[model samples]
Target: MAGPVHPARGVSYPVTALFMVGVFLLGAAFIASYVGGLHAPHPHRVPVAVAGPADATARVDAALRREGDAFDLRTYPTTASARQAIQHRDVYGAYLPQQGRLLITSAFGPTTSGLLRSAFAPVAAADGLRLSVQDVVPADPGDPEGLVPFYLVIGWIVSAYLVAAIVGLYRGMAAITLRDALVRLAAFAVYSAVAGAMGTLIVETGYGYLPDSPWPLTGVGALCVFAVAAATAAAESLLGIIGTALTILVFVVLGNPSAGGPWPLPLLPAFWRTAGPWLPNWAGTEAVRNAVYFDGHALTRPLLVLAAYAAAGIVLFLLLAGRTNPVMRFPAHSTA
Candidate 1:
């Protein structure tokens, strides 16, 4: 026979059960949200260019619109101009109506190229012509799926927050001085440099993926790591333990889905599409891609966004440090 339970013990049982239930709910929510967002991706207004006679262009535009708003159509004077648009990242794919040729960049992602092919094949078939596909920029052989950029960004993000969390745990926010904060920032910088170099080596040399020179990739990686680490440190300084939770909420819950990693931004739902460009994941991924494939076209915007985040985080951290320990001022009237 069991003895009667103590009051504290009985209370603890329900508390433990509640905590377990909360953990389960959080896990369940993460899975459900990601799966729901990515289950069936449909293009909303994916940009595509067409170059041909005015009559042919009008017919193609009408067909694209009839296909359920799958494309945002642009007209180019020549097929060469349309190809240039694809290379410049202005359009995902281009069509030459007269030649029945489709120009796509598999460098973006094989899935994107596949989708474009499927969408345009029917249009070409309607004209009793076979669609001739041309990949102007194909992905590296080592990363045929074109997911290396996304995975690389993910690695940087996880390392950034984990490093910040460990530092915060070692030195509680209340006990952290301005010197301590600066030291932490210094450590983060060194770690970012090392991590960036190592990651670049692994992706470029070891695996033979990512055709860009290591220097540019390493530079972008370092910036990405520093941006995330500084922001996470600032969050922790301001909010204590809850700051870590906030970091996860921002980087994991919202950032990942809207990152345009597995699917391009134009194919996502409205909310994710709108939010993708603003988030670090998308910025970092795009920056890496540009550095590798597009000769660094359209890189300035993402770099600026990352710089802003790093600056904001550093400023906030300093402000918090000042609040915690006010500097003592000596009166001018008194001499030593």
Candidate 2:
């Protein structure tokens, strides 16, 4: 007789396999995100406007062509048109021949601009031209160094999310239903308004750090806060305790360092640049800059992205909430 053949003890092989698969997926996610973030930008398809008189146009076009993979050059008859293109989102930048100046309006990461600036230098010299720099859309005065509005918005986002997370823990993730989700979101809106008002007031009147209309800042701040809180609530609803870690993974660890706040996206290493725009951190930063510096230009895309995140979170929380374990669920909490 064969010795007692004990069936597999503890976890079954299939269960172990499933567990391994989950681990693999998570690991893959981290690797893919991390590597994608670092991948080098080849200056592929970067739009630029070139403007000058007939001869100047031709010369500028030639120089831009020689500049290679970096520039997708478009020609304009006058500098005003180029500026218009930039303001209208037609181009990231424009070069003016008569003034020998380059106009930048887009809030591209700093590294990309630095690269362009340096590249323009050699080309300008070789072509017997001089270079001057102009920022059609400048940053806010109070924004610390390169990251002013970025950090401010980040602060608001973190606070709101912290509130949501705390509420979830204390109250227990509620038996969130469709109505409940909407109510939560509605509550989020009110909380957002308060947070935004306070943050904006502090930054503008309280500290005099930002020189801009306080109302606009407050409005934008409210939107940002809502987005973050909604997102946190949704994440907590989905992942239970793991949601907090995931939040750190997405918004803080990945979001902050990669946020174009301190160095601008381009100035960051390749990985950070690629991942920056996809995260709420980048969206919030861009939106803040648009409201304060870019004359409200270039804000639509980022705002839409943030709105999408908020909408998605609300939908997820409402739809799948019934399946959640009440004991493990996140109720009203503070993420601040």
Candidate 3:
């Protein structure tokens, strides 16, 4: 017999191989998800508020309808009412036909404002009037694109999941016992709080990007961070290292595209639009924006979603505590 058969390179470096393949697949999925979500931005039935003379409102509404029902118009009795709707995020833009002004919320979405300008400018010109666009809830001067909030929340989520993954890889995917799991949760809570505060500090105190109340952002940040971390930790407890990959798939590959960040909800494909509001990225971004710009007008949904994830994750992690990591066990490389 041959003296002693040895494992091939593939078997010897199994961890490296697994990670390489996992990364490759993840990269592909990343491309597919983003491309599929944003490649075609056919906005249809976008809600808009129209006020002023019936004739002008009808004219714009007719034009919008002729363009494949691009806008679903709601006739408000007064410009004040239309402005209120925009603050509530009920409408993307309001066209005051009599005043020949378009009220938009860049905070709602920069692209959305641009779209409104494009649509209303020509209509106003047709009537021999110059359309003046005003951003009622304008994006922060520092963050003219209104992308910082989304990016900030994305940073929190990424760190949250990475923390869970790293902790699992080093100590074991699952907790060593009930106490261990409890401790882990508590530690993450503190970490989440710190992360949230630090983000606020950087955004508000450092750059004054979002010159609104800091407490709300802090609360949302902490909740979002804890939720993602707990969710990832719960998955790791049961699935070992593969759980991290699954976490990335859910949070990054799918979550980012469906986040309503890189693109507005109306501009996104149907799948992403339907899927956006359910993910942490979407909830977090919305909540942050609500705090910074909308004065927390619609924060209940995002908060509820984050709380559900955090609660369920903590419960599951506790129940499923104490398990071995199948992949990260690290067998001895030395041969006898």
Q: Assess every candidate by TM-score.
A: 0.88, 0.74, 0.90
Clash count, one per candidate: 0, 30, 0
lDDT (CA) per prediction: 0.81, 0.71, 0.86
Cα lDDT for residue 30, model 3? 96
- Candidate 2: 10-residue stretch with minimal lDDT: 327-336
lDDT of 1: 0.81
lDDT string, candidate 3, 1-336, tens digits: 345444332355666777899899999999999899978776767899999878878887877776786788899989999999988878888999887899998885567788889888888888789999888898888887779988999999998999988888767789999999999999999999999999999989999888767898899999999999999999998787788889999999999887777667777888888888888989999899888888778888888888988998999899888766565555433333
* Number of the top lDDT candidate: 3
TM-score of model number 1: 0.88
Q: Give one digit per residue, the lDDT tens place, for model 1 in 103-155.
A: 99887677788988998888888888899999888888777778898898889
Candidate 2 residue spans exceeding 4 A from truth: 1-46, 53-55, 61-68, 105-114, 141-144, 176-183, 263-275, 321-323, 326-336
Candidate 3, lDDT over the whole model: 0.86
Model 3 scores worst on lDDT over the 10 consecutive residues at: 1-10
lDDT of model number 2? 0.71
Off by over 4 Å in 1: 1-25, 322-336
User: If the candidates were sorted by their lDDT against the true structure, best first, what order would they fall in?
Assistant: 3, 1, 2
Q: 2 or 3, which is superior by lDDT? A: 3
